[model samples]
Target: MPAVDPRLLRYAKATRVFLALSVLIGAGQAVAILAQAWLLATIITDAFLHGAGLDDLSGQLALLAIALAGRALLAWVAEVIAHHASAAVKSELRMRLLHQVVRLGPRWLTGERSGELTTLATRGIDALDDYFARYLPQLVLVCFVPLIVAGRMFAADWLSATIVLVTLPLIPLFMILVGLTTKQLMARQWASLQLLAHHFLDVLSGLGTLKSFGRSRVQVATVEKLAAKQRKATLASLRIAFLSSLVLELLATLSVALVAVSVGLRLVDGRLDLQTALLVLILAPEAYLPLRLLGAHYHASAEGLGAAEQVFTVLDREIPATGTALLKANRTIELEHVMVASPDRDSPALDGLCLTIPPGRVTGVVGPSGSGKSTLLAVLLGFTRPDAGQVVVDGIDLATADLDDWRSQIAWLGQDPMLFAGTVFENIRLGRPAAAEFAVRRAAGAARVDVPLEQVIGERGNGLSAGQRRRVALARALLLDAPLLLLDEPTEGVDPDTEGELLNTLPAAFAGRTVVLVTHRPALLGLCDQVVELAPAAVAV
Candidate 1:
């Protein structure tokens, strides 16, 4: 794939007005610089050699001053325009990427690392700044400025202009040679970053487990090793970038030196005028300036390109549109020859096992750890699409259904509920943002979550006990007013007394609705209407 993604056209479309203005302003600056160089050179040659008057000198100086001021003003305006355009492009692309991921569904995102996704959304999208702000404008200037400068140079002295043209290819040639290494280095650097992200996120997610087992020191050693590898990869990338910059700069400088030497020889030989010699020297640097800057930024942008590739991989993944009939709220579920595989493993989590969830019944799913309990729940929740067979809900296939609508009809309470860092009011209201205060209170009461709604949930609900978090999650789901509820390990941490009270209170709230509760607790199972056992993979296989 090319470094510049064609998909970036979405961002390019975001601020067309500002982009146009930025280009115009940038070109204006080039024009100003060129004119000032021309005027000052002509004025110097006239006053020193041609014996021009002081008034003529004053007039030329005034013109030069105006050009300089205009260049400064245009440069400032260009910066303003470029900054806003870059910001708009970044914001639009971030939102677009997020929307793309969400629409593509869990099949694409579920198995991916959160930290890598964070890096992609932040630093990866930022690479477009180079593509749009630096590379693009320079690309434009590369066309206009160099051509204009070369034409002016040729007009002054075709001999020196030809010298510049001949040596110009050398810069990109060496840059290409250096850039070959750049691509390889960037690939390695990105891999290292992804590895670090994977490790870091895994560690953070399991930090509590590590502490409980007193193995945090072991994990710390592992993290240090990973960080060391990342540092080495980073240095390797920077070494290539610096080398690329050096090679490009050296080539451009050599070309300018050659042009200067030719112009000097011509002037000393009495075949060229002083003004023409000066113009040739000045315009020579202008011709190679854009090319030099492009080389430098290209290296910086390659890392971003690597990250974008990963993001594109997610967006491009095939999420089948099965055209299966939508499963809406009758609460009846039938699993026929259902099989779901672990994304990071070879074996199926739920093998070709059939089961039925009776409509509007409080059914319990019980199994040992790694015995396909949670996987079955994920499949029910539409997070893990089964590799084989049908998950039929209310006589409709889960695949073809309008997922958002199907999921909206469900109230879910998972083993570890996701609680954003905010007041409990916000977390509970997540089920329905427009839910009234009294409605929220009613749901909270039904879940037996005694915590005040005004209390803030710390990061990951660290402020609450395990049972409290589960209760809050149950409250949130209840606030949805959905007809069917899925609860995973709902009463695992609650005391037997609280668990009994919850089981008794919970069924009343469901009235005519259905509930599927998962738990290993005898206390919770006793209260359920039905109990289903999931055999181990060994037995199913």
Candidate 2:
């Protein structure tokens, strides 16, 4: 990532506002710092050199106290502003990133891993807290504070000011050199960390499979190795950051020393007054303080900067254009020469595939495995766009119809039912948020979900048997009462008895609704009003 990414400003409006406020606060802080330094110097010179009694210096002491309190207050305000800005930016970025990921659709996401994406949206983005909270505010102060202090020094002692001016460039120059080196290291560390997280999530998801195969113990070693590698990468990145801080601190210290020597020599030779020399010495370190802190905090934020680069890359990807037209009430759907190619396949998943799903009827789509049955349903659901084809619903081109509106008319049940961590009633209610309790119970009964509606289930329906979970999903679908119903292997994982019950209930449950059922089961096909068969390569309408 560049030292400053424009995407941060482009994507996060809150960050932009925070930055603007930070600049204002930085200006006030700069003024407070100057006042604090001047008063402290004045108090020291009057008490020590002029032999001013405590009574005589009371006013100066009070003014110095006020300046000190104001500077501390401004620091606190800057910290608070940075913290809120970080939180707001993180929230905004996560929301936008999630929305964009959904907009990209599953077709695009199929080539990506869920674990990696999860880490990116969660822990990866969280790393940016330091970037906004500490580094960014210091960056603003680095710009303003040094200039303010240096200007005051020039008025007090020109030779000391010149020395400070000539040496200040070295700090930033070395900082840039160190930053260039650590940038690559930090990127590697972040990549390793992501891989480690992905590996852990993958292992957790497949633990059942590994245990079934008696290889669970073997994976433990692999996980440990990956973890060790991640730790090493983290340490290496930190080492580089520490080295960079050391270099900045050394440069700043040497620069201050040179300024101190110049001020001391001038005061001894009567070229500068005691008060002016004391002020110059005091403000010299203040001029370099912000720059030094900026360098140190920059390293602290390097990981976040790297993650931000990947986030920007994702955000920059182009999504297929969506339409604004609405689906007609009739809901008759047609596919004309639809071709959807999978990323890894040479041939299209659905090539020259034409089909019609008339309103108020049931249509069964049957095909061999990988015959684009699911792909056809995906096109209808607006989850995947055809590369070469048109989809029309009631004479309105689906390509020109609002996808959300079209989807709103659909109640979809995939091969695998998805269940959240909630009561059975709550899960079913997800189909229609405002549905009445009587309606939910009726739908559950129709789907053969005989359990009490209040029974709670674990994530992914852990407490429910495979057949029960499928019925729960079916109950949810039945509750929706959408104009269109799309079921992909709805009876999968259920026993023959349960399948028979579902087949018996499905016709009445889906009465008067347009349905596109994707199934290979002959029993399911027997219930459809019409059956469409697809071949591996293509199917003619």
Candidate 3:
């Protein structure tokens, strides 16, 4: 929002090079502006004062044409460069922000609004087109153009140059004041817009539930209310933007008028020649053009700047620490006084609890709802960090072990197994991308995925039955053959026959592997080498 934000350069180094190129182009453009003004003035004075014919001024007119064409070409080039730089910066920022979010994991994101984040990554970032394509290029021009034009004016007419210099500061002075107000308004408008987007997405995702409960009309009213608030905030922000542009236009116009009056008066008294007076009049407007355009485009880009500020806030958050040590072959895991606090709850999810899972055996973790069952799994998977203790693997602190390395050794199946949009074979191969076709078919058979291996599944397994989707996820986990297997409610949605078949395969599938099984199903407990029961919070206390 200032002439330039430092974060822009910090996030996009290519922008610095782009700005440098813009400076060079702006300097060339300034020279073209000065030359075009001088040539036009020279030709006009020849025709009007000296009664020269068209032929007498032909050479100067030709030079004037070249200057005009050159200026237009330079302007076009500047725009193209700005667009390229903008695209590169937006891509880099989006990718980096996504990586940061993934590193932070679900525990940190539990309290965040998904729709708001999606809007920020998509529409919010797209708004920055104006900032890079229009405002940034003009910002460079403002620094170079005015000084170049004013310097030429001094050599031609010192008094006119003095007047120009005295009035130039007024444009930026008024711009800063209006820009401060506009920045606040733009930020508010963007925040309201994000809320509206979030509400709209939420309604769409839950439209089925709303209709079933006969609350669809009620939700429509809620959406309308949010839409109205967004509309009001947007209009208010636009009013300020228009008002600021009007003020800047008036100030620049008045400054040029003052310069014209002084030049005309000097010409009338025979103190200045027609050529010098015309040059001053022509160059005066050019001197103030960059600053005026900069102010106008600044308002247009305010929303993007505000969105960028929010992106920086997300990127600045702390992520769970990862280490470089490789997980060894012995897969015994120990939790030492582990404590994990829930985001919305008053007490810790897992409070000062300790457990040991021996190597090469299946362990069952049974607990009531909200008794830290899922939280314990999250900690084991390195998705959440313990507040007061550590997790050790083969006597090595997992906190100091490489997360990717440790996770590569694990195959996880959650209560609601996530199945993506892909062919059955493709989804299963996601666990190990280089898996053989034979291996995929074998894993699918083991999980009782009856569909053809090439059958396509819609987004979030929409086209498949709930039981089929769970089997696909199971096949994915089985295909990986990871040293550590973790299953949470593995047979939750399947039929009894399919569940029995899966239970039968578990023993062979988990043979000689360390496994942590979390389930309420008694059938699953029969296959565990050791069953650990987690008591309620009050009982644990």
Per-residue CA lDDT of model 1 for 371-393, tens digit only, reads 78877877887777888998888
Cα lDDT of all candidates, in order?
A: 0.79, 0.86, 0.87
TM-score per candidate: 0.86, 0.96, 0.93
Lowest-sum lDDT 10-residue window in model 2: 532-541
lDDT of 2 by residue, 379-459 (tens): 988899889988988888888878878788889998766799999999999969999999999899888896788999988
lDDT, candidate 2, at 165: 88
Using alpha carbons, what is the TM-score of model 2?
Answer: 0.96
| Candidate 2 deviant stretches above 4 angstroms | 450-452, 538-541
lDDT of 1: 0.79
Q: What is the C-alpha RMSD of each candidate to the true structure, in Å?
A: 3.5, 2.4, 2.5
lDDT comparing candidate 3 with the true structure: 0.87
Instruction: Name the lDDT of candidate 2.
Output: 0.86
lDDT of 1 at 234: 88
By TM-score, how accurate is candidate 1? 0.86
In model 3, pairs of residues that clash are none
Better of 1 and 2 by TM-score: 2
| lDDT for each residue of candidate 3 in 434-485, tens digit (9 for 90 to 100) | 9889999888888889899788887668678878988889889888998888
